[model samples]
Structures are given as structure tokens and as C-alpha cells.
Target: MAATTAVQTKKKKDRTFVTTMKRLLKNKLAIFGLIIILLQVVMAIAAPVITIHSPFKQNLAQSELPLFSEGHFLGTDNFGRDLWSRIVYGARISLLVGITAVGLGLAGGVTLGLIAGYYRRLDGIIMRIVDLLFAFPGILLAMLIIAVLGTSLVNVAIAISIWSIPTCARIVRGSVLSVKKQEYVQAMKSLGASDFRILVKHILPNCSAPIIVFATMRMATAILSTASLSYLGLGAQPPTPEWGAMISQGQDFMWTSPHMTIVPGIAIMLIVFAFNVVGDGLRDALDPNMNLNQ
Candidate 1:
């Protein structure tokens, strides 16, 4: 009877924790954001299947076709490329940039943050560098990097990753500082656990919540940044179906076929907005103090 009671008590605690998490997810705005994010992901994945026109194929005769015209649903650009098709393909560039840049930033930042947080003497030096990077606006820093590296997809990713690093590092460092002072960490030290083991097992797991939230937010920023770079001719080159490049290519035809520019612009706005909403929701959902109403 005693053993059964103990098992039931443990299960109850676990259920309570899960219920709390569910309550956080119950926020309608967060749920909506999640849905939109998922929808975008699906659209990106299904881009090829959804569109018949190759994003690169151009029809000068049908140039600047407006929405709902002829065969083109969203219309055609100055180059007569299908707007809908271009937008679908553009998703690949945006997702690629967002994921790659954030992944690089997260990996580098977390590693540096852990090292600095664990070693008291190194903290000051590492944080100073982060602070210096943070002083400049991320966009401006990306611009500078792009200018120096020259216009290319790889350069855009690198520039955005550079801007992302400081913020990610700061977040991870703060989380690590908090976790390092915990009793478990102290116990680990007393047990003569290796530094790597303590950091990987005891510290990193507890710091994940904040890191995840930051990463989500950074993804939105990365997408926007990539677009901005492409707008400036520093990203995915001509004939490539990138949203920013599409907008740039369509600008001249804006007076004739506004849908050319407007469609791609809307796509960028929607993607960035969706990501921001989802990121905000994730932050709220991950808050430990939140409770689900029964």
C-alpha cells in the first residue's frame, strides 16, 4: 500500500507539471501563432507540388500580368515569371537562412557562454566582446559584414550569424550564471564531477528554456535580415527565387503590375509577423509560473 501510494504521488506531481505546461499553451494568440508557423512550414515544404511554373521560367510576352489574370494566379513580374511560383520558392531561401544563421549563432554562443560563465576570470573578457557587438544595431552590423564579404548567400548567412552571436551569448551566459549557483551544481562539484560533465548535464539542461525562446526570436530576425540583405543586392543573386530579390526585381514594374512587388512584400511581412507571434507565444508558454485554468 505504501509503495503504491508513493508511485501515485510521483505520478500526480508529473501530471501537475504537464498540466501547467498545457495551460501555457492554451493562450489563444500563442496557439494561433503556432498554427501560422506550421502552415508556413507546410507551404514551404509543398512549394514544388503547389506550383506548376518553374520560379526561374520567364515569359516576356506575359510580363507584368496582374492578379487573377489568364493562367497566372498572383500575376507575373517584370520578367514575366509567375509571382506565386516565385513566392513559393522564396520560402526555401528564407527558411534556409533563418535555420542556418540561428543554428550557427546558437552553437557558438552557447559554447562561449558556458565557458565564460564557468570560468570567473574569463567572464569579463568574453562579455566585453559581446557588449561591443551589441552596441551596434544588428542590421547595421549585417550591412557592414555584407559589404566586406561581398554579395552572396553564404555571406548573408555569415553576416546575420555574426549579428546574432552576441545576443545569444548574453542570454546563454545569464542562464548559465543562474544555473551554476544551484545546489545540484554545487553537489556535482563536491562529487568531483568533470567540468564538462557538470556543464553538459547539470547546467545546460536547465538553461534550455531561455535559449529556446531566444532562438525562436532570432529566427524571425534572421529571415528579415536576409531579406534586407537581398534587397541591397547582398543575398541570393538574380534569377534565384528569393523574396527580397523578387521584390527588387519587381520594383520597376510596380506601377504596371503592383502585384509583382506587393505579393512578395506581403509574403515577407506575413512570414516575419508569423515568426514574431510564434516566438512571443513560446516565451509565454515556457514561463514556469504560468498555470492552465481548468
Candidate 2:
């Protein structure tokens, strides 16, 4: 009977996922966003193969070349580094930091949320910590962590992850609170199921909808925040092909070689847009009240 019930549950979950995906695909904005994200991912992965020239090698002679110049499709920065190569490589950095930071933040947030929501005795203490973190503005909080950890790409990711923790925990805690009140959760408690088993198997599965939405939206925030930090000279440093850093480098040549800054700025905007629209789509698709048929 237990095995049969488990099989039914698995089938139901699969059906739900398929339905959500079908709904998501029906959103035109989401399809466009996915295309943009896919293109960026392809460019990032094929950086070495697709790039016309080295992103870092400087050539004073070719410095500040106009866009569409031979051997330099997108032109060159002040240092004569290939704008196309730098932009392509920058995608790798942006995506890496965004994904890593969010992954870490989600892991920490989910654990704390599970403990706090499951154990009434721990909820107060855990929530207090989350509240304290939330007291600071997100960017300010990230800056403070970066100040202590010192500036570096790795440190930037860590700081952003720390900054992300409070919001993720709050979201997860709310979801958990609601989920744990469900009849199934109460039944699990009375059936001698371990706290770990109940939380991980039953409670977390039910809470996945909100968590998925949060993660998608948070990816947009994470990538944008990374660019902001790097632009402020606190994230990826000089010589790094990070889009924010590239923009910073090109600011001086904005008049003569505007593509240096404009190209990378556009890259950032497109990626952020991609994530935001996809997130919006996921939220709508995952909402139980949203009719999939419509």
C-alpha cells in the first residue's frame, strides 16, 4: 500500500510539473526571456571559440577603434582589449557569481527556515537573526560584508549570498509555516515520522512552489547586484572581463569609444530582463489559483 501511494505521489508531482511548464511556455514574454538567457549561456560557453581576439591583450595602436572595425567586430576599449571577447567572457563571470551566491543563500536559508518552522522553540531566535539582517538595506549589507571580507570576486559572491539569506529565509519561513499546518503534515507527525523526514519529504515538497519563484526572481536580483558592486569597484577588479568592470573601464572613453561601455551595459540589461520575465512567468505558472487551461 505504501509503495503504491509513493508511486501515485510521484506521478502526481510529474503531472504538476508538466502542467506548470506548459503554462509557462504559453507566456510570450517568458519565451523571449528564455531565448535571451539561452543565447547568453551559449555565448558564455563558446567564448574561446567565438571570440575574434583575446579579451585581455592590449594594443595601443588599435585603442578606441570604432565598432565593426576589421578583426575587432565590437571595437576595442581604451586598452585595446577586444570588446566582443570581454563581453562574452563577462557573461561567464556574471552567471557564475549569480548562480553560486543564490545557491549558497538558498541552502542556508532553507536549513534555517526548516529548523525555525519545525521547532517552535527555535523560531524566535532564528527569526530575530533574520530580522537583524533585514534591518540593513540589501546593497549596504553586501557592502559591509565585502568591507570585512575584502574585495574580490569570491568575496563578492559570498557577500551577496549573505545579503540574500535574510529574504530567502523570510520567504521560506512563511511557506513552511503555512505548509506545516496542512493535514498531511499533522498526519505525518502522528505516524512516528522523524522530524527530518517530515520536513524534507513532505513539508519541503509542498513548499517548493514559492521557493522556485523566489529563486528565479532572486537570480535577477543577484546578477544586477553583482554588476552594481563591480561598478562601485568592490567586486570584480581591473583586468577582469566582468561586464560591470568593463563598463567602468569604458566610462572614460564614453565619448570617443562609446561602444566600450554601451555594449556591456546592454548585456547587463538583457540578462537582468531575461531573468525577471522568466521569474514572472514561473510565478504565474506555479500559482495554484492561476488556471493552466487559460
Candidate 3:
């Protein structure tokens, strides 16, 4: 009987996944966004093979070459580094930092949220701290963190992760508050399930839909924040092939070698757009009110 019930549960999950995907794919803009994201992933993974020139290597004689110039597909920067190579490699940093920061934020935020929602005594204390963090503007908070932590890519990631925690905590807390009141959770408690087991094995899983949607949308914000920090010289430093730093460097030569800034700018814009659209699609697709067959 238990085996049959387990099989039925698995099948239900499978069907839900299929339905979600079908709904998501029905959105043309989301499909376009997914393609862009996939391309960025491929470019990040195959950067070495995709670019002929070294992103860091310089040839002063070839500096500031225009677009589609000989041997330089996207042209050379002020330092004669390949623009295409730098953009391609920069994808790795953007994706890595965004994902790593979001994962860390989710870890910390979800813990606090679960504890706060499940244990009412801690809710007031936890939420006060979260509210305090939320009072500050995100970029200013991130800048303050970077100032205290000092500059570096890793520091930027840490700062962004910290900045992300309050919002994630609030989201998780709300979801947890709603899910905990459900009948299944009450049944689990009556069955003598441990608090940890009830939270992790049951409550958390039910709260995941919103978490997933938040994570997807947060990726865009994370990438944009990383770029902004880098542009301000608080993140990735000179010659690191970071997109924001590249744009910062290219700003001086805007009139002469605008391609340097434009290329990275376009890359950043497209990536953020892709994540945003995909996130929107996921939110809609995950809605129970959405007609699965439609």
C-alpha cells in the first residue's frame, strides 16, 4: 500500500513538472529568454574555444581596433585585448557570482525564515533584523559591506549575498507561514515527526515554488549589482575581463573605441533581460490558477 502511494506521489510530481514546462514554453518571450541564457552558458563554458585571442594578453600596436577588424571579431580594447574574449570570459564571472551569492543568501535566509515561521517565539526578533536590513537601499548596503570587507570579486559576492538575505528571508517566511497552517503539516506533527523533519521534509518542499521563482528573478538583480559594483571599482579590478570594469575602462575612449563599452553593455543588458523574462514565465507557469492545457 505504501509503495503504491509512493508511486502515485512520484507520478503526480512528474505530471506537475510537465505541465509547468508546457506553460512556460508557451510564452514566446520566455523561450527567447531561455535561449539567451543557454547561449550565455555555452559561451561561458566554451570561452577558450570560442575566442581566438586572449582576453588579458595585450598588443599595444593593435589597440582600439574597430569592430570586425582583421583577426579581431569584436575588435580590440584600449589595451589591445580582444573585446570578444573579454566579454565571453566575463560571462563566467557574472553567472558564477550571481549563482553563488543567491545560493548563499537562500541558505542563510531560508534557515532564519523556517525557524521564525515554525517557532513563533523567534518570529518577532528575526523579522525585526530583516526589517532593519531592508530599510537601507540595496546598493548602498552592498557598498557599505564592500567598504568594510574590502575589495575583490569574492568580497563582492559576499556583500551581494548579504544584501540579498533580507528579501529572501521575508519571502520564505511568508511562504512558510502559509504552508505551516496547511492540514498536511498538522498531520505530520500529530504523527510525532520531529520539528526538523517537519520543516525540512515537508514544509520546506511545499514552500519551494515561491523560492524557485524568487531565485530566478534575483539572478538578474544579482548580475546587475555585481556589474554596478565592479564599475565603481569596488568589485573586480583592472584587466580582470569583468564586464562592468571593461565598461568603466572603455568610458574614457567612448568616442574613439565605443565598441569596448557597447559590447559588454549589450551583454549585460541581454543577460538581465533573459533572466527577468524567464522569471516572469516561471511565476505564471507555477500559478495553480493557470490552465495547464492552455
Candidate 4:
């Protein structure tokens, strides 16, 4: 009977996962967002094969060339570096920062969240730490961390991850508190299972939906924040081909070559927008009230 019940529970979860995917696919904006994200990933991965020129090499003779003027399709930067190649390569850094930040935040936050939610004794301490982080705005916190750590692509990602941890922890803590009261969780508790086992095998799985949705949204914010930091000279320093660094470099030549700013700016906006839309879609998909038929 116990094995039968466990099998039934697994089947139910599988059905729920399937339903969520169906609803997500039905969302037109979400589908578009997924496409944009996939394309960016492809662009980042294929940067070497797709790029037309060396992102770092400069040609003084072709300096500040306008878009579509000649061999330089997106045109050259102020130092005569290829804009298209720079943009292609920049995708690698931007995507790397976003993914790494989110991964780090999720790892730390989920552990802290599970501890706080499962152990009443630790809740106050963990929550107090989270509250302290919440005292400052995320960007301000990120800036402070970056200042202390110094600037680079990896450091920028770490800073953003630090700021993002509290939000994920809070979200997961809430989900855990709510999930703990469910019948299934109570069933596990009534059994001879240990607290860790119940929390890991039972509670955490149920909380994954919210965690996933929040992570998606947070990824967009992470990308934007990292770009802002790079623009301000705190991330992926000179000649690195990062989007924000590229935009910063092109600001002076904006009037002479608007494509310089326009190209990378659009890339940043599109990727961020994609993540936001996908997050929204996931939120709806995960909602129990969502009517897939509707």
C-alpha cells in the first residue's frame, strides 16, 4: 500500500509538470522569449565561427567607420575594432554572468532557505541575515561588493550573486513554510523519516516551481545589473568586448556612429525582456488555478 501511494504521488507530480509545460507553450510571448534566449545562447556559443573580425585587434585606418559603409557591417568602434565581432563576443560574457550569478544564488539561497524553513531554531538567525541584506537596494549592495572585490567578469558575477541570494532565500523559505503544512509533508513527518530526509525528499521538490520562476526573473535583473556595472567601469574591463563596456566606449562616438550604442543596447534589452516574459509565463504555468483549456 505504501509503495502504491508513492507511485501515485510520483505520477501526480509528473502530470503537473506536463501540464505546466503545455500551458507555458501556449503563451505566445513566452514562446517568443524562449526563442530570443535560445538565439542568444547560440550566438554566444558560436561567436568564433560567426564573427567577421578580431574583437580585440584595432585598425586605426578604419576608425569610427559608419554602419554598412564597407567590410565593417556593423561598423568599427572608435579604435577601429569590428562592432559586429565585439557584439558577438560580448554575448559570451553577458550570458556567462547571468547564468553564473543565478547558479551561485540558487545554490546558497536554497540551502539557507531549506535550513531556515525546516528548523524553527535557525529561522530567526537566517531571516535576520536575509533582512540585513534587504536593508540595502540590490544594486547598491552589488556596487559595494564589487568595490570591495575589485572589477572583472567573475567578480561582477559574484557580486550580483551575493545581492540575489536574499531574495531567493526569502522566496524559498516562504514556499517551505507553506509546503510543510501540506498533507503529504505531514505524512512524511508521521513516518519514521528524519527531518532532513523529509525536507529534501518531500518539501524541496514541491517548492521548486517558485524557485524556478524567481530564478528566471532574477536572471534578467542580473544581466541588466552586470551591464550597468560594466558601463560604470566596474566590470569586464577594457577591450573585453562586454556589451556594457562596448556601450561605454561608443558613447563618445554615438553621434558619429549610433549603431555602436544601438546594437549592443538592443541586445541587452532583448535578452532581459526575454527572461522577464519567460518568468511571467512560468509563474502562470506553475499556478494551480491556471486553466490550460482557457
Best by lDDT: 3
Q: Decide which is better by lDDT, 2 or 4.
A: 4
222-275, model 4: which lDDT tens digit per residue?
A: 999989999999998998999988889889877888888899999999999999
What does each candidate score in C-alpha RMSD?
3.1, 1.2, 1.2, 1.4
Report the lDDT tens digits of candidate 1 across residue range 1-294: 979967996897588667746764676776676777787788889998998999989899988888998789898888788888888889888998899999998988999899888898999999999989989998899889888989898889988988888888888888898889998789889989999999997799888888888888888889988988898788989988998988887788777777877888988888787778867776776676653435
TM-score of each: 0.92, 0.97, 0.97, 0.96
Computed on alpha carbons, the lDDT of every model, listed in order, comes to 0.85, 0.90, 0.93, 0.91
Stretches of candidate 3 above 4 Å error? 291-294
Score candidate 3 by TM-score against the native.
0.97
Write model 2 residue lDDT over 87-114, tens digit each, in one string. 9999999999999999999999988888
lDDT, candidate 1, equals 0.85
Model 2 clash pairs are none
Residue lDDT tens for model 3, 13-61: 8888899998998999999999999999999999989989888999999
TM-score of model 4 relative to the true fold?
0.96
Q: What local lDDT score does residue 111 receive in model 2, on the 0 to 100 scale?
A: 89
